[model samples]
Target: MGFRHTLRDDKLYFYERRDIMEQRHNYLKKIRQYRREDRPIVYLDETWANSHMAPERLWLDEQGRGGWKRPSGKGQRLIILHAGSETGWTPNADLVFRSKKNSTDYHDEMNSEHFLEWFQKLLVNIQPGSVIVLDNAPYHNSVVEKVPTKSSRKKEMQEWLTRKRIPFSDKDLKKDLFAKIQLSVPNRKLYATNEAAKACGHIVLRSPVAHCELNPIELVWADVKRYLKVHNKTFKLADLEQLVPDAFQSVTPEMWAKHCQHVQEEEERFWEKDGLQEESVEEYIIELGTEDDDDDIEVRDIEFEGEGEDSDGEQDECEPVMDENDRELLRSDAVSDA
Candidate 1:
């Protein structure tokens, strides 16, 4: 009875966290390298402005507790894509999409094509020697069709290898019996945004997964919500659309500077801490301060619902489905049978 075994708690995703830190270190090195070159770096991200979003309570006084009810309706929301940088917010580089619910019952969303269109604008307007920071969303990291992991290429795969100038051919190259051939090469040019950025004479920097603290835009979002909450009296979609522009415009350049500086400090802190997630972080306060998220407010995926056809505009995975033709090809036997 005295000899009882003790159970220990397991650390979930321990190895995964370490891998993420390793990624952080590598990215930080790249960032520092860019900084030394005097290349401007801008952090980019997308967020949803929901119609049902607003404050839930009031500051309670010793004399009385204050509570209020806000009107509700089926209001639409818009998905806005914005960017911020060290200098300040980029002028003439924000996109807004009317998010409507599609037949799939989800929300119409921003996919790779939409992002790429905006990204083209971003590249054009941004300064030379600039690094556009992004999360590891699939779209941002989209690249040319990677070589398939096969010994020989289909007509298309063969063409890709030739175009990429990868030296591997059943004719030009020989393989040992024990060894295998690989048409697919790792570390090849990433597709979509990465490839596009490089082609446009800009750099694409990606934040590590699970490291939200590294993006100043996250803090900017909190401020935007606080602004919306303060002015959101009637939860109407039309008003929300109008308020969104106001909310974003309300973000002063000083706030952007503070948030960006805070992100750099967080990067340094993360490095000093050797990748361990901090129990506490000194938060960057907005000019309007912050608001408490209502406990009843349901947190959904980033894309807000509107009235439209169902789509895979999921920002969570941020996967880009290049174009309609590409999508069809992937679905067809051309690539699948291969």
Candidate 2:
């Protein structure tokens, strides 16, 4: 039969696309469903250090808090990793430790190995649930090796053939090991990380791409930075090691609960507007594009390889959308209560 379309008189075919707001709505709806169903869920994300050094700013508590010296200028960057659950903030870690591998500079970046090490530590301790809220970042994914197939080297192919219980015996299998092995098609099966997640009891809920508002941890970062920007007087890397964790601790459990509720409100807005924000409508006029260069909070994505690929040769590549954060404007009310 030839290709067909709109055959029934009662219906017509139309291609439709969900706008960004609608996409956000869907993301929130799904996560809420997980919560509604009482699924174990934790929001995981990372935020890097920003360039908000004070030529100097610090707070001295009337309660006799010690003072910090102001720096003349800037210093090295840092990265922070942590997770948030409905209960509260998870213990946080900063990437300012001297690199075990390089030993020259601080651990300023995250990779598959770094993420995996963190996951191994996290997975065993997680609540008995089946979801991990990871963004579409490459570092969050890693590949697993596939079992060798029949088309193997003499030794490997024979070993695989024996294990697969193919018709060939010791002698015939030996002959086919190095000889030309043929079949109707190539058995191109590569590994992907979802399998490992399945084994670990997670259904990995990935956040929508380019949507930071959907991640509650985004709110956490905003609060944390508000603290760091105020307390960063010494502008010393050693001082940051102390300041970063303090900021992470500043976010109360109530704040995380508020973030979850705020996301629900956003979802409700989308649902009521049918995902049509005024400016999001196709015919709406817009101003010329300009970025808020002074914005301190920046989210970046890095790529990681997935399980196996098809028989066809292809490789995963990184996205060049780097968030090279520049200097940040100090908060208007920096020196508040220490």
Regions of candidate 1 where Cα sits further than 4 Å from its true position: 1-16, 59-68, 71-75, 102-108, 149-181, 184-187, 275-338
Candidate No. with top TM-score: 1
Candidate 2: the clashing residue pairs are 138-303, 138-304, 190-308, 191-307, 191-308, 192-307
Please report, as a residue range, the 10-residue window in candidate 2 with the lowest summed lDDT: 283-292
Off by over 4 Å in 2: 1-29, 50-74, 91-108, 146-193, 274-338
Kindly list the per-residue Cα lDDT of model 1 for residues 1-338, writing each as its tens digit.
68655532111222134454556666666776677788888878876666666665677769876655555542456677788786667888888777865432222365566778899888877887788887654455444454333343355445666676765555543332112224345433445676677787887776654456777887887788779878877777778778877888788889998998998898777667665433322211111100222122221112212221112222322222234553454457345644
Q: TM-score of each candidate?
A: 0.65, 0.55
What C-alpha lDDT values do all the predictions have? Answer: 0.59, 0.51
Model 2 over residues 1-338: C-alpha lDDT tens digits? 99565432210100022333334455656666777779877777765443334323346789858665544333455666778776786544233342233321122256666776776556655676657776655545444432333334466655555565655555665345434333421342222334455667765666654445556777787688678767776566677667877887799999998997786676566556564322322211111111211111123222222111211111111111212321111122223411
After superposing all C-alphas onto the true structure, candidate 2 shows an RMSD in angstroms of 16.8
Lowest summed lDDT over 10 consecutive residues: which window, candidate 1? Answer: 283-292
